[model samples]
Target chain A: MFYREAGQFKSTYQTDQAIFPIVQDRWFMALVFIVAFVVIPLVADEYWHQAIIIPFLILALAAIGLNILTGYAGLVSLGTGAFMAVGAYSTYKMSTAFPDLNIIIIFLLSGVFAAMVGMVFGAPSLRIKGFYLAVATLAAQFFILWVFNKVEWFFNYSPSGTITAPPRELFGVLVTGPEASPVARYYVCLVFLVVFAFAAKNMARGRLGRSWMAIRDMDIAAEIIGIRPLQTKLSAFGISSFYCGVAGALYIFCWLGSAETEAFDILNVSFPVLFMVIIGGLGSVLGAILGAAFITLMPIFLTNAPPMIGIHLAADLQKHIEEIILGLMIITFLIVEPAGFNRLWQIAKEKIRKWPFPY
Target chain B: MSAEPTVGRKIGDVILDVANVSLSFGGVRALNGVSFDVNEGEVRAIIGPNGAGKSSMLNCINGFYKPTEGMITFKGESHHQMETYESASQGIARTFQNIALFKGMTTLDNIMTGRNLQMKKNFLWQALYFGPALKEELENREVVEKVIDFLEIESIRKTVVGRLPYGLQKRVELARALAAEPDMLLLDEPMAGMNHEEKEDMCRYILDVNDEFGTTIVLIEHDMSVVMDISDRVVVLDYGEKIADGTPDEVRANQRVVDAYLGVQHD
Candidate 1:
């Protein structure tokens, strides 16, 4: 069974202390890796990669970023879209300025820029908490988007207040831009996702992550127990922004080669990512990925199903139906299992593991 | 264990000296010019009736609620003016009157958070999750595990603290504070909701912590028997004033303390 950890003995403290101690989970992860790296590339088309996989991966990263701040640190941020814009715009500028730089370097560098912006926005958390902090982050969201719209240098003097991704190569192979192959982009994204996921898992098991959790659970108690609230909150903001920035870079460079300020509009983009986190499960990394994938694919399937089934619905009507279906699914998930799709998956796996026992 | 030390040290050797401390919330004076001295390695209990400003005194000491009018010195350094977060980094750890375990986290995670002040890894290393970050996590885990074992919570190591019983949750909160390895431990009513057995267990733990770790404890408790039993010294407050301060036996026998609890009759 996918959930079983039977017969795995940990002799050392290190093994026992791993983020995931179950042997079954390790094997399942390996299987997932194979499917993502090998089978999906061989079977899936460019349409599937662009319309589903890329958006899924990007949204998953964004959800993870928000989860770090909102779920673990208990600091809600409405300005996630602004932080993402910082990432996208910074990446665009970096790539344009240094045309010879590798795409991966640009992506990582953009995260640093986003981290700074996030820190600036997160400064008010020291003075305020909970709903007040949430409102402060909303201010950041509006302020950042305002800068993107008003400042010409941010968009590299573009008349339309939009930034365009330049063609980029890594090791003499095209990985982004129109000339880049979908498989290459998919692999690059998947690899970074894996690396970041591993790092996030480790961090959550370590001191910094524990600090965030402490602050989330009880800030006063955390202080009395020797945790500095400012440092912990700032760290959460930095890391969460870094993740969002990288995802923003991925969104512009890998999926939508050209984007305007409206690309990061809070209602259209940021709220959807927030919904993904809520629908997946707030504090779990795997839940972020699962929620992203489900949200990404569900809309595509709904839009395309009528045509496949030989029922030709009008395009506008089809779009409306998709939204209605998505809304219903979100409400149903929230009402039935607020922990999201990840919890459902976990329960299903547990049930399978305990088959015939009614556990 | 060594024999109990003599209580003959002068007030001049005081590790914590509060001078003219007063905290007013609007029209009410929570603590009005309250003054006291706590010596090093002494278990000092602050006792008072309801609304006697006992908690306000502790809050001021830890830098939670800044006093409007006085100075508090710890080891000859001003601490009253310091921020609450800074107080923790400066070798102070405390438990709240309310049990404050991170509800969603396991007991181990809650305690590990206490070691946050001591962790030296930066954001870069933390994000990378290798090298110094990994080493720090391992080291911190070792210390946290020691605390867990010390508290005899090995079986419930993975249990989320909120799901635990009240006594165990209180113990977990203490474990979290103790994980800091502080020079001083501040406990706000550690035995408030405990049953007789739980209270006994907690008293043993408190005494053992002081004896084994050499941690100076300052606790606020209403139970006079507990204050007399475990504390080396007791300080009583009434109407935001320091009524008495001495050895537990001395404080117990003080006529003022009796009058505060039983009230005075004027013929």
Candidate 2:
């Protein structure tokens, strides 16, 4: 009864075609926003903000980027880490070049820089696809990492070769660098995630998103029907990279405050982000965030919970066990539900709607 | 073809002209020296058996396949090659024989994609999905809705097309092509996997599209019965060459056409 639509009526096309059309869904979204914007910030401790929440938010943004490409546009990319590195480097360079500008603006511009690089790398995608394209992007991953490693200018030729984000002030309060509070960094990540996530969702529902999906569905048919495969695909890469870039910037500036180039090592960052997209559900924004939570929290749970249960083990051994579980979970999730967590969410909603009877 | 005034217009209304066009993939020649002109407001059917270059000819016309040698002129313009989207924007739209609906997209979204060239919201507006982008989207949604209604697919408008029955999926493909408001419609095989009732439905819709909008239709169909009933003119290909070009009946009567279809007697 709680989930039923009952007598709700929509009087306009805009209202009828809303993102959250159901009244209950709208209320639920409103409640979520209230909790996110107000309640959690007031009550949550530093540990939650630093260890779990901040990473989740950053990874969720990256996963959404990958989802736009692989999920909506059917362009598999392993260059996510590369694109993110561009963002991080861009943020580093931009902030250093112009310290007077707001860090948020720098973050956005960093994504644009990453987007340009992403589109350049995405050119080959027009000619090659599937595993071949993935291999091509894998090259981007390695080459970008190499460039960052070899080119000392990217890290500002620091002795340690680690780029440090200096503390930046917003409204007379610090928001980045070592001096900034975890809560401040959390707020920044949260805000960017919310804004960018909604922007991505908006795109997925519109003409642009439709073009991406069109190219994904059938390239030959898409070509005949007049959707330019190259343009559609490149735009997907551009936009997806833009989001990843911002996430990358946030990852370094807000969460790490100081990051070695190795922090963005492809295996650790790109693979995990991609796994989130797969487990979260391809093409669903909510799935990205949910997947981020699952990935971010699971390791902590795995490592700590085992010890709590008197199954104490070395940290190295625990990490191997964690990897095995995570890998198995991914395989099981893919085999059982390719639609991922989004499909599960839909199924639950459907069950609630059809309660009391096995339809 | 003899007395169809709605099609055939006058002599100067040639919308698409293919002169000495040939296409090949490495050692295999798909189309060899095929020449044809599609006039304004006509159902120009290109029918042939499998591997007879029917699909290849359509691909060449729509800019998917570059002719190994020859010229293709469309609407008085002659370009050696144009991008597929460029051809589409120049008012060419097509459906696939294999039914190429965006599987992840809803029927509405799939149809809206057909109108991609027409919807011109810029990146900034599209990202926000507000102001001009939203306006353009809602405007296009109306067009897609009309297409959905025309194809009698309103029930599945919100449904993802991959889950649809094969017949309905084919209809959705056609609807998507029509949503482009194309001047020339290239249908690879509109009625390939349909039952009698579904084929009849598709036939009526195709006829209605040609009649109502004066859309120049180029279809590839194996069904001789449907071809005879619908096409104002038919171009028949066999073994990478145009064996016959005339009215459906004339092509049906041509010796080369009969030989291509039934094969030469070897006794």
Candidate 3:
């Protein structure tokens, strides 16, 4: 009665390797794209675009970046914020220096710059593992943000030490800076999100993805079996950082319009993205999106609950409640399902396949 | 016993020459002046008592542990030093005494990973695995599936290796190493911890691999009967030094081999 692949036959490797292997899955994805592009853009209010949809897409991309490193490669990294800082700053420099290049081009170039930085920080992973690697990446998170804060040239020598993404256009419509409409910015984020998300999915399913998984399962066995640890680990960092870098650029240009170093703070960016990967499911693209949605939506419920119940708490107290609630929710979710929502999703699918029958 | 003799070059002159290879860890010496050579297509066995450095010698050949002294020449090319990945690329493959399969991955993925050295899709093509990359992937998958069938593990092909029983995991590990289609296969106690039935099955597979594929094999085994029945040549080690080297029957009669390996108390 539910989803089934009984009659589906794979005639070629390409067909077998399709991202949406099932007909139902293909339909589901088409529906999602239609809702995101056609329906939401036309129907959603500015609050929905600015406060929910735009931030959701940007964070989902970031979460995917972290998921690639920790979830797929089995290398726990805390340098996500640092890599994002690299991207945002790189974009700032590229846009200001050229003043004529397209915003999309600048976003991509910034990712390359961040990927290089990610590789440098990822070098220590060859010798150290697990918690030690996490500490090393945490060091990168702090160090890069520190550099961004201190370097005057990065902010164009502005007194405020904040970089405002200058006005940029796409096909004669301003899509960046404060002048861009919420719809225009959302479209920009949407297009890049689709491209990067598709690229990440394909990359994770192929040889390079297998290489990362091999390294994740057992480093020594991977080495003995001919997988180069140096290359595999570095490639994971590069691609992951590339995604984070682009998202950072998008966050500054398409969402925030202007950002300070604190916007890339470790507490704000690194831990949140890590949580998104954990709650969503590591090593899963769908989980990354699901996780971003969960993290973004939960705060609304947490903060508004007290108000609805006729308790007006101070802003700081409200923030504490959100933190406590998030912490508890994460802990509970992990204890219940260490593999996270992806595993839950899988279990649900299996259940539906055997509906009205004993599992 | 059912194994047909190897189809290709049955056996040829020495293919690998290990000369005076000695290994040490900190103050302790694992091997001292160990020397041996295996001819092509021969099932060469290295038998030893515990701590006799049988595993260490295999490690040295695969370049996992650098010899503190001595040399190893494979296919007549002397190796000064080499990395583990380089040794694999050179067609020297091995299974661990302790199973080293990728536990989180499926039997299929684990076997597919064996084709890593052979698959030539670049990162960009692999990132878009729809054109040439897909073709290459399917071709290699077909080869790996054949190995899976030969090992009689088709039923467990999709199972994650971590959940499998020990004997099955060992077989899967061997299948993975074989999927590489290497010239030489090194096995560290391939039959260790197996019951008699499993041992017999593994022994048959090894013989068939050597026979049908003409692959040069050097294996470390503790089971005396298993070693004597299969190996064309036997090299006995005692405390990291070669004590006897000959045909299995000759080594069985040697006083030194019996004293060191068999541990017979002489009057």
Candidate that would win on DockQ:
2
Q: Rank the candidates by TM-score, best first.
A: 3, 2, 1
Once model 1 is optimally superposed onto the true structure by TM-score, how far is the C-alpha of residue A158 displaced, in angstroms?
4.2
TM-score per candidate, chains pooled: 0.94, 0.94, 0.95
| Strongest candidate by lDDT | 3
lDDT by residue (B51-140, candidate 2, tens digit) is: 999988888888888888999998989977777767888898888888777888888888888888888877789888788888888888
Q: How does model 3 score by TM-score?
A: 0.95
Alpha carbon deviation, residue B32, candidate 1 (Å): 1.9
Better of 2 and 3 by lDDT: 3
Which candidate, 1 or 3, would have the higher lDDT against the true structure? 3
Task: Compose the digit string of candidate 1's lDDT tens values, residues A1-359.
Answer: 44566778877667878766887777878899899999999999999898888788888888888888887788888878888899999999999999988889989999999999999899999899888998998898888989989989988887777798888988777888777899888887888788888777777777778888888888887776667888889989999999999988888888888898788889967788888888888777888888888888899889888899899988898899889988998898799999888789878987988876897
Tell me, per candidate, how large a share of the native contacts it keeps. 0.68, 0.86, 0.62
C-alpha lDDT of all candidate models, in order: 0.84, 0.87, 0.89
DockQ scores of the candidates: 0.59, 0.71, 0.64
Q: lDDT tens string, model 2, A1-359?
A: 57866688877667767888898898999999999889888998988888888899999999999999998898999999989999999999999989999888899999999999999999999899899999999999999989998999999999898899987888888999888998888888888998888898989988888888878877777777677778889999999999999999998998888887788888889889988988999888999888888899988888788878899888888899998997787888889998899999999998887787766
What is candidate 1's lDDT per residue for B36-149, written digit by digit as tens? 888777788999898899889888988989999999998778855777787877678888888878998999888888888888887668767777787887788889899999
TM-score of 1: 0.94
Q: For residues A240-332, what per-residue lDDT tens digits would candidate 3 score against the true structure? A: 999999989988998898989999998888989999999999889989989998998888778889999999999998999898998899899
